[model samples]
Target: MLNALDNLTRLISFDSVSKNSNEPISDYVSSLLEELNFEVERTTYMDARGVLKCNLLACRRPLSSHPKLDETQSSSASDEETSPKNAPGGLAYFCHTDTVTADRWTGPGGDPFSAIVLDGRVYGRGACDMKGSLVAFLDAARKTPHEEQKLPLWIACTADEEVGFEGARFLTENSNAYTELVAADPVSIIGEPTMLHVIHAHKGICGMQIRSQGHAAHSSTDMGVNANVAMVPMLQTLLEIHNRCLTDEALRNDAFDPPTLTWNFGVSDGMKTVNIVPDHSNAWASMRTMPGVDGKDIIEQVKRRADELGLTFTLYSGGDPMHTDAEAPFIREFCELASTYIGPNSPEAVCYATDACAFGQLQHRVVCGPGSISQAHTTDEFIEIEQLETGIRFYEDTIRRWCC
Candidate 1:
């Protein structure tokens, strides 16, 4: 079991930054899963610069080959009938292997590729944000009892989650075997650093870049519409839309803090020099909305505002909101099983986005995993050793209950 943590430490030691190469980490994970008798599939993306990013999916079927039972036999059949080959359903576990740039952190402990441990914490980039959760899932799968009744387990470790969920999107579109999905990101569980929570819902994300066009001219004459000046109204309109979202009851989720849609204008760029009126200006913004809110409506509202100002703009990416029933059978069962290992009150909602949206579109019941969201993307990111062990136990117990 501890060897899994060591594997995680080694995974973090490789710098799989979002923009840089992830092949090393991907290859390492692929080899590990293969050694465990999992059938592995690899996917790679080539950037414009020809740098290759990679993702790995590993699947394992139980050792038994049981015949499908007739309707009359269903009630009396053993759990082995649900094994991947004979069962009508399957489950998938997903995690992103990429981390944000190490440059964001400072001090001697900040290097993302260097694994350090102090005070019982394994410090490194990607340690807490996701690699921790990823490793926990792997360990759980590895340690799960090989019973005849267990369903098949699929583990997907992908790239580009930090920059975007490209890897997850690709896997979902390409794979057709899974019936349920779990995203092992850190944000799902938030309680006392113990593995006691399951997240059933999360906000959806849409990122947009709005560019305003203007004619360049000298500042002294003001002959041309300054692109920067044009952006002011755009920003104000966005703020109004953001404020309006706060008042929308449909966007609110009682499970989340603040329980409303969130929008942010994160970056703006226009003129290169102060003395000149810029010909073009652009601003990047993102919206995080609850399950029922239409991200397209909010985006159109912004576009309408931009059109009213006669500003030319383009949208980059848009993501839809996702949610699963809190009372879903699988959710309830997983929550109950998690409680057996980590105690009760093991459910919550998150404001961040995950591949859950994609899986939800396919009608899969999605849930968040156990880890600390706060530790993600921070310097010296780490997951408690105890949490990993607890997660392994929970997975093992859940598989045993469902399969046997």
Candidate 2:
């Protein structure tokens, strides 16, 4: 069997960028899991571009399938055992198998897929963004003790996470596999770049577009209500809303960075030329709100404001916030395990979003993994060899804690 670093090197060799077919990586991972005696299944789906993709679910049998523990002995009491089983419930590792485009990653190597190891770091497109954690999880699973425990263990590698989380959505909406796996209310750990910090909360996301309509006419004629002019009031209203959220106690969550609702009106479209009074004008904006703050409610507020200004509004995308209780048993256990390496720390809330928001809706979930978010999408992205080893130990410990 390939070592963790070797597995990671093989994984990086596959260009599983978002929107591209991840069949190769899926095949590679499925083959590995099958070799390890896991019941591996793939939830195949087509991306927006109609490219074939998949979400892999590999389940190892429960500890009960192994020899029973002695009356006064713990699960670790035995040194000889068999492969794991996919019994009922157990802890799950959820990670996106897709990475963002590597257009900007111009490392010393010729290409992002080289997986160059220099200065004790693996430099590649997906090294820090994700593939690192997936490699660690795979390695830990390879090292798992066959001793008896109460629950099983699952690994979920979903596709299109960078492209609207379509893979996760499919798993949630279409797969009975996930339903069965989480039937026992197992804990889910989303493998994103958190530098091993246990992230318990994250803001929700909602994206919208507001359009203003008017009759087209020559600009000099003054014969039509300029759509651009009409759009100004709507933009001002959204700014006002943004400012209000900054000070609104109801929307504030001190645990997250900035501790306030964030609004970004970064896209707009309007008249084609100065000579024309635009027949239509539009602005695209997005908001990130604290957990427990409904993004739909914020959308409704925006819609109401648009209505007041006689403008049309449309919500194109959105996702719920994730907030696992800091005191959750799984969370405490994970933090304790992580603290041994990174030092003691409390559960944190990140302003950025993740696929955890998708799984968090169904069960207890937390976002914690190796590497740094700072290098996630940057050019020359890399993950330290030390972090990889740390992640391997961390995941191995976590797997043993719940699935001895």
Candidates in order, TM-scores: namely 0.84, 0.87
Off by over 4 Å in 1: 47-50, 66-90, 145-149, 176-194, 221-225, 361-364
Candidate 1 C-alpha lDDT tens digits along 215-277:
877878959777777789888888887787778676666777768777777445545677777
Q: Native-vs-model 1 lDDT?
A: 0.65
Off by over 4 Å in 2: 63-88, 147-150, 213-226, 270-280, 295-297, 308-311
Candidate 1: RMSD to truth: 5.1
Lowest summed lDDT across 10 adjacent residues in model 2 is found at: 70-79
- Where is the poorest 10-residue window by lDDT in model 1? 183-192
What residue pairs clash in candidate 2, if any at all? 60-85, 61-84, 61-85, 61-86, 62-85
For candidate 2, write residues 1-404 as lDDT tens digits.
Answer: 89988988888999999968989999998998888777787889777788999999877866465422222222221122322322213578989888899887788686998899999999987888899999998888888865554566788899988876778888887776676665544567888989899998888777888888888888799797777777887777778777878787887778888887787884355445688777888887888867766656667877998888888888865567888778765577778999998999888889988887677544567899999999888889899999999998998888887777
Candidate 1, position 158, lDDT: 73
